[model samples]
Target: MSDGATTRVVIIGGGFAGINAAKVLARDRRIAVTLIDRSNHHLFQPLLYQVAMAGLSPADIAVPIRGLLSRFRKVSVVQDTVTGIDLEAKQVSATGQSWSYDYLVVATGARHAYFGHDEWESNAPGLKTLSQATEIRRRVLQAFESAENEEDPEVRKELLTFAIVGGGPTGVELAGAIAELSRSTLTKDFRRIDPRRTRVVLIEAGPQILAAFSAASAVRATRDLEELGAQVWTESLVTDVSEDSITIGNDGEKLRTRTVLWAAGVHASELGSALSGELDRQGRVPVGADLSVAGHPEVFALGDLARTEDDSGAVLPGVAPVAMQAGRYVGRLIRAELAGKERRPFRYVDKGQMATIGRSKAVVETGRLRLGGFLAWAAWLLIHIYYLSSFRNRALVLVQWAWSYVTFGRGARLIVDREWRNPET
Candidate 1:
C-alpha cells in the first residue's frame, strides 16, 4: 500500500456503512482512514420519520461525524461533496479537492426517484435528509394553521387533507403519525378548525401496501391505519401532481390537498455514474460476492450505492443492517489481504424486518417468528434505541417518547422557516 508501511483507505460516505467501515479499519494501526460526506452529521435514517412527524427534533436523530469518530486517531472526517472518482489514479475528486487512496469504499446513499416526473418534487417532498424532514414538519403544521383562518369551507377542507404516496414503511409510518397528530394531539389546539376531521390518504401503486412483507402483515397494517382514521388506497397510480392537488389512476380522480409527502421510489446516488460499469435499473453499481467492483480489486461499494445479493441468489434489500454488515466485511477483507491471508466471500445475515404504525402499533418479522401490536412495538423501540449513535440521543428520544405517550403532545412543532406563510394569511 502507501509507502509500504500503512494502507491509505478513503471512504466516500459518513452513513451507516462508512462509519462502521471506519470503526473496523481504525483498530489496525497499519490503516489510515479518511471519511468524506456532504453533511457533517451521521443521520439515523430509520428515525427520520419521527422528525418529520414532529415527534423528535433533528439533533435527536443526528450526530456530528467528527464527534462520533473523535477517539480514533487514524480516522479523519471531511465534509465535502464528491464530484467524481478516477479508477485509474485511485483518486476521489470532491468540490475543490482530491485525495489518493490505496483502497476505496464508496457507500453514498440513494435519493428520491420521481419516475420521469421531476417537476412533482417541488410539490411533494421526500424524507431523506434533516432539512427535508423539517420542511415536512413545517408543511404539516402549517396546513392546520392555515385551515384555522380560512373562511371558505372548501379551502379549509383542502388544507386539512394530507396525501402520502407509497405504502412502504416510510409512507405507513408517516400516515399513522400524521393521523395521530391531527386527531389526538392537535384536536383541541385550533379554535375555528377541527383538526380531528383531518383526512389522511396513503396511496400505493401495488395491490397492497408493504408489499415486501407478508400478505398477513400487510392486511394487519392496513387495518391499523384504517383504525387510526387514515385511508389506505391500493392499486392506484399518481398521474399528476400540482401545487394544491394530485390526480390519480386512469379514471382521472383528483385529490385536493396542500400537503403531499412522497415515499415512493429511490434511485442510487448520482456518484455511481462516476464509475465505469453496468448499473442496474435503479442505478446501483454491480458488485461481486466480496462487495468489490468488477475488475477493480482495490475498490469496493456498499449500502444503497451497490447492487448486492446473498448466497441464495436473492438480491439483498438496501437497508441499514445490510450496509453495516457489508462495511464490516470490507474492512475485514482489507485486513486479511494486508496480512496475506485468504479472502473470503461476504455473507449477509437476515436478522429481521420491522415497521411501526402509530403508538403501540407495529409489525415485526424475524425468521419464523411473527409479532404484532404492543409487544412488537416495544421490541421495535428497544432495538432502535439500542442502535442509536450515542447514549445521549437514546436517552433524549426515550424521554420524548415517554412524555408524548403520557401527554398526547408533541413538543417540536415549531416552524422555524421565515419564508413559509399560511395561504390564508
Candidate 2:
C-alpha cells in the first residue's frame, strides 16, 4: 500500500455512516480522510424525539463532528453543502469548492417525504434534524402557553389538541411523549387550561401502526398509547393539513389542532440523483454486493441514500444499525483493497429492533424474543445509551432520564424563540 496521502477519501455527510467510515479509514496512514457535512455537529437522530418533547436538550444528543475526529491525524472535516458529484473527474463539488478523491463515500442521508403534498410541510413539521426538533418543540410548548391565555373555549380546545401524522416509531414515540407531557409535565404549570385534558392523536394510513413489527407488538404499542390517553387512528390518510386543522381520510373529517407533527415518510438526499445510476422510487441509489455504484467502482454509497436488497430480494430498512454496519463494512473493505486483499460482499448483522413509548413502555423484537413493557423499555434505554457517541452524552441522558422519571420535570423545557408567533392563534 502507498503511504503519505497517496490515497484520498471523501465522505459526505457526518451522520452515523460517514462518521464510522471516516473512523475506520483513518487507521490507514496511507489514506487521507476528509469528512464533509453542512452541520458542524453529528446528531444522534434516534433520540431526536426527546428533544422535541422537551425531555432532552439538543446538546445532549449532538456532538461536534470535528472534535470527535480531532484525534485522527489523517482525518480533516469541511463544512459545506454538496451540490453534485463529478464521477469522471473523481471529484465532489460543494457550494464554493470542489475536492478530488480516490474513494468517495456518499452518506448524505434522507429527508422527510410529504408524499405529493409538499405544501403540508410548513404546517406539519417532521422530526429529523436538530433544527426541526427544536421547531416542533417550540410549537408544542407555545401551544400550551397560548391555551393558558386564550379566553374563547373553542380556541382553547384547538390549542390543546396535538395531531401527529404517521404511526411509525417516530410518530408513536412523539404521540406517547406528548400525551405524557400534557398529562404529567405541564399539568401543574397551566392555570386557566387543564393540560391533562389535552388531546393527542396518532394517524396512520396503513392497516396497523408499526407495520414493520409483529402484530402483537403493534397491538401492545397501541394499547400502551391508549392507556396514555393517545388516540391511534389506523388506515387514516391525512388528506389536508393547515395551520389550524388537518383533514383525515376521504370523508374529510377535520381535526382542529394547533400542533401537527409529520413522521410519515422519507426520501433520499438529492445527491442520490446527482450520481450516474438508476435510483429507487425513494431516490436511493441501488448499490452492488460490495456497496459500490454499478459504473463507479471507487464511489460507494451507504446509509439511507443506498438501496440494497437481501438474498430474499427485500430492501433493507433504512435504520441506524444498517447505516453503521455498512459504514464499518465499507471502511474495512477499502482497507482490504489497499492491502491487496480480496474484497467480500457486504452483509448486515441483525441486531434487533426496539421502540420506546413513554415511560416503562416499549416493544422489542429479536430473533425468538418478543419483549414488551418494562423489560423492553430498559433494553431500549441501555441500547441507546451504549450506542451514543461518547460517555458524557450517555451519562447526561441517563441522569436526565432518571430525574424526569422521579420528578416528571423536563429540564429542556425552555422555549428560547419568543418571536415565533403561533399562526393558528
Model 1's number of clashes is 0
Query: Which candidate gets the maximum lDDT versus the true structure?
Result: 1
Error of 2 at 21 (Å): 0.3
> Model 2 compared with the native: what TM-score?
0.97
Q: Write the per-residue lDDT of candidate 2 for residues 56-121, one digit (tens) a residue.
A: 999989999999899999898998888889998888999889988999999999988899888888
Show the colliding residue pairs in model 2: none
lDDT for each candidate structure = 0.91, 0.90
Task: Show pairs that collide, candidate 1.
Answer: none
* Candidate 2 ranges beyond 4 A from true positions: 1-5, 418-425
Q: Compute each candidate's TM-score over C-alphas.
A: 0.97, 0.97
What is the RMSD, in Å, between candidate 1 and the native fold over all Cα? 3.0
| Worst-scoring 10-residue span by lDDT in model 1 | 416-425
